[model samples]
Target: MQTAAAVTQKKLKRNVSLAFFAAAVVFSLWYINFSFSEFIGGIPIFMNFLFTDFLPPKASDLPTYFGPVLDTLAYGVVATVLASVIGLVFGFLMARQTTPHPVIRTVMRGFISLLRNIPFLVWASILVVIFGVGSMPGIFSLILFGSGFLARVYAEAIEEIDSHATEALDAMGAGYLQKIKHAIIPQFVPGYISWTLFMFELSIRASAILGLVGAGGIGSQIKLTMDLFQYNRTSTVICILIVMILVIEFMTKRIRERLI
Candidate 1:
């Protein structure tokens, strides 16, 4: 009877706490600087941009975009390839189970964390200075981001695998390479492909934005048109880009589904 009473008291306390927290959130939302009024005030501006600025898109710019489109696709392909290779190496090295060395794993983890957190823009800026402004900087930045992301994913995937499989490989007098090739790689193939696909998707967006820094791609054309107040051309360019991205995504999805 005493224990039952205690449980009821704890439940009541938790309910009261949650109720207060919910009330506080409701009050904050109603009175905060980020209230719906802020969005309401911007509706007119959004309407003007959508109705006045984006209508009658200049479809004439489509022809001129072929080269830039190809360049962007090429950039994504190259960056994804490089990132997959680098990420695999780093991921394997960083995996605690794979490394089995405290210091080395710590260092690798730190490096991955650093690369993951730093924005691609910052890397692009640094690369621009060193590589002297071109597609290369964009490619390098994509490589950095993609590699970091894939490395983390790969490492986590490795950590989730069956320890027995690894032990079996080890019992056969297998070295690290042999254990990975026989035990790890086969199981990792699907996850590796998935990560590569995701990185390719990310690289596509990164490649598009690289043109903002003169990294050379379709983004440069959009930037130039927007700077000149050629809104129609910019709108048309975005439309084309959307269609291209959708097509690529569709094709990739089909392939991945088949493969998986």
Candidate 2:
């Protein structure tokens, strides 16, 4: 029967896909220099840092570290807000809905890719040198990162929207701004909000690391404690960061569920 033949073909295709995937996995491991000894060698250093350098967290310096935590939070919030706003405008420009120019879309997409390709640390490092050790570099780096990501997602969301609705709006002679404000925004509000929260969650983690170059967060606190050989305080800071991350994760999950 034709059904039997089709089923056999599907099975054959599946087997071929599995073979390719299995080969790729083997090739990846071989190419990457993966070794058990490499992992074993790194374990002890981590153990030493954990057991000797970071045990019995000291709570004495809580007051001193408080300011830096607030600074980091402020940096993340400011950067996220700025990124979302800029992304809104740029996303409109980047979306082919308004422009419909292939060249512009390609350029915008390429720029977004470029922004995401560089590691944030590398961008933060360069920014620190140009701006000099502070929250400004951290915030700016996040803005660049967030704007690029949001612009692409926003463009895709716009493009995927119902054409009939857009057509109806066009028949009414609605201006581009009005059409976008009335039609596009309402349709995409849920997705936009979800992504914005997602970005904030990422910002929370990035904010912590951004302080490494003196961007002013718990990272700076960790650096300071390490410099002073205060492993106890460092442990406390680490614990606090872990809790903050968990709390943010929980909050984001709840918000996302509610939005849905």
Candidate 2 structure quality by residue, lDDT tens digits, 1-260? 57988999999999999999999999998999889798999999999888886887877777777777777677778877888898777677777776557788788778887987787778889999999997788888888888888777777777777777778999999988888888888888887888888888888898767878776677778777878998889889888888878888899899989987
Best by TM-score: 1
Any idea what lDDT model 1 has? 0.84
> Distance from true position, residue 128, model 1, in Å?
3.1
Q: Write the per-residue lDDT of candidate 1 for residues 1-260, one digit (tens) a residue.
A: 56988999999999999999999998887786565776998999988987798777887657888998898889989989999999998898888778757798889999999998998888888888899878889899989988999999999888777788889988889898888888988888878887788888777777657778877777777788889998888888788778878887887788789887
**Residue 140 Cα positional deviation in candidate 1, in Å, after optimal superposition:** 1.2
TM-score of 1: 0.83
lDDT of 1 at 136: 86
TM-score of each: 0.83, 0.81
Model 1 residue-pair collision total: 0
For model 1, what is the alpha-carbon lDDT of residue 108? Answer: 93
- The C-alpha local distance difference test score for the whole of candidate 2 amounts to 0.82
Candidate 1 clashes between residue pairs 3 or more apart in a chain or in different chains = none
